[model samples]
Target: MRDVLRIEDLVLKFRGYTGVTEVLHGISLNIRAGERVALVGESGSGKSVTARIVLGQLQELRSAQVQGGLYFEEQDLNRLSRRQWHALRGTHMSMIFQDPTSSLNPVFTIGVQFTEVLRRRDPKLSKEAAAKRAGELLNSVSIHDHARVLNAYPFQLSGGMNQRVAIAMALANHPSLLIADEPGTALDVTVQAQTLHLMHDLVERTGTAVLFISHNLGVVREFADRIYVIYRGRIVEQGPTQAVFENPRHAYTRALMAAVPRITGGGVPEIQDMDGAFFDPLEVHGEDRP
Candidate 1:
């Protein structure tokens, strides 16, 4: 498959009174057409920042300095004007943020927001037609009571329901790429699993390449075709999902895998990045890569 999104040596920095604080240190990754790729790291590891930059969000901030090439379909994202970037967002790319509450408008009814999203792809679509299409989209994400959902505000619904609504809106246009940031992290384990499954099937059938950002190794194992292990601000290791799971090369990757709580209730091992040995780049290649 051809690469739908590619980041080459991306570096992001925020200018502050204290000085420039570098958050991402020349990180690079990509997602091919219809491929699912994961970027895994603990909090403050710059996973979400990478996703934001890819979506052209960072370019909107005056204080943010984004270096390196960000390409979507061989077009340089850096070269795009703000209006041009806005035009690409909803139809060609969309993002489901970490929290449904944050992504969904608090004041607007879900139906209204859903219609607005649908309009991004079809400007001339009537509200009545958009409403009907929204209902079908909601149903695709397992939200059966589409009428109630459309009429209700984000705060009125349960976390899982709101998340389903968020997913429904994100995939409404069948965008070429989706950036899902810790999707379902706010819901209960069972609900999270169900949400993930629904999202997985929808994206697969629509052929939408996904850049899944999360700290959950177990979820990444099941959801991603390839995995990129990040530590601090750098990509420490990357390989095919099973290859990384079977033999995590970097100390951080091994420690991260060992830290996952087992279903059998085994002891969670202490992380041993041991003297910061694994902070350097650990590249995996050949048969192990996707």
Candidate 2:
């Protein structure tokens, strides 16, 4: 299968009053058509920055300096103009944010917001048609009462309900690629599992390639076809999901895997620094940050 998304040595830097801060050193990964890939890392591991770069959101920041190749469907995303980014964002690729309630517009009803999403692929679609399509999309996410859910505002629904709505909207246009940034992270374990199941089934049936960014190993094990372990903005290891799970080569990957609680009831393992570099807590002057 052809690759839907490819990142080659992606490096991102932000210019500040102090100096330049480069976040991503040189990270590369790809998602083939209909393949589910996960970028696994802890917070500030440059995962979200990579996602924003793929979406071209960071390009809007005047202080942000981006280097290296980011390709979508074999097209050079780095060369895309702002107008081009706008054109490609929703129609060719879509994203589910970390928080459904916050990512959604509290001001607008779900119907209106969902209509906006659906209209991306069909500019001439009528409100009635959009509503019908939205109902169908909601149904796919297992929200049967589409009428009520559509009319309800984002704040009006529970976290799980809003997450379902978010998933429905992200997949509304049936884009070739989906970037799910830890969707349903705020929901309870059972609800998150159900939502993940729904998302997995939807993508599988729709044949949409997914770039799932998450730090949850258990979730990645269940959802991703492949896994990429990232540490401090660098991709240390990547392979088929099962292979990586069975034998993690990188120290960070091993630490992450070992940190997961097991049914055998051994407490969490001691997670050591991947590089074993000691950071003096008392030292106010630290090394260069990512």
| Candidate with maximal lDDT | 2
- Clash pairs detected, candidate 2: none
lDDT of 2: 0.88
Q: What does candidate 1's lDDT look like per residue over 1-290, in tens digits?
A: 68999999999999999999999999988899999999998888898889888888887899999999889988999899999999999889999988888789999999899989999989999999999999999999988998999999999999999888888889999999999999988899998999999999999899999999998887999999999988879999999999999988778887666555567964444444657543222121111111
Query: Model 1 off-target regions past 4 Å?
Result: 263-290
Per-candidate clash tally: 0, 0
Estimate the Cα RMSD of every predicted model relative to the unseen true structure. 5.7, 4.2
- Angstrom error of the Cα, residue 290, model 2: value is 28
Model 2 lowest lDDT segment of ten: 281-290
Q: Tell me the deviation in Å of residue 147 in model 2.
A: 1.2
